[model samples]
Target: MEFCDECGSMMKAGEGEDHWVCDSCGYEKGRDPEAEEAMETTQGQEVSEIIDTSDVEDKGLPTTTVHCPECGNDRAYWYMQQIRSADESETRFFVCTECEHKWREDDH
Candidate 1:
């Protein structure tokens, strides 16, 4: 069994692939050589496609109704989708709906 880098969960090796998958955290690691190459190429392309959200209008973005659990700000709180994997890796951000305070949701 292998360990997920993100969540540190034990992963069982798949039958055909050399990769291991963590069932508890849904983390997949050790991709096939071809797949890894393709992913690398895709990542290079994505670097050029990064968008500046600061230029977007307030009305254009989807607002979530959750209050800032940290700041008690009710009027404008950013709702970020956190992707947590079995290896304990997570990516989350917060964009205050009212204050426009762009920050990582878990930074606090």
Candidate 2:
């Protein structure tokens, strides 16, 4: 992806495939063949298998006794993530061990 030099915004493809144009500032720059090659090389690479963490029995995550609303399971794995502003508390996430149900608890 190309960025505009004048407005510092992401540039879009120009009329042809050889250049990129910035819609915000009307700036244009020649597409770099090396950058394009690198992007293609990365994009063409084989993608690894995606593992569903919730279904996995062991994820090295801490366990809690929180109630699962979906399956009525008492055991679950819990983790915290900051889903709000920096000053706010981190949200607590839980995945049921039995039914693989995911839920979150926020400190709003």
Q: TM-score of every model?
A: 0.32, 0.47
RMSD after Cα superposition, model 2: 6.8
Minimum summed lDDT over a 10-residue window in model 2 is located at: 42-51
Per-prediction CA RMSD (Å): 10.6, 6.8
Model 2 lDDT, full chain set: 0.77
Candidate 1 lDDT, tens digit per residue, 1-108?
357898898888766778788888888877566754565334664465444557345536655655665465654433344245557755555556555566665566
13-44 per-residue lDDT for model 2 (tens digits): 98877899999989998988886777644533
- Candidate 1: residue 40 Cα off by (Å): 14
Q: Candidate 2, which segments miss by more than 4 Å at Cα?
A: 40-64, 67-73, 82-108
How accurate locally, in lDDT, is each candidate?
0.60, 0.77
Q: Model 1, residue 16: what's the lDDT? A: 78
Q: What is the Cα-based TM-score of model 2?
A: 0.47
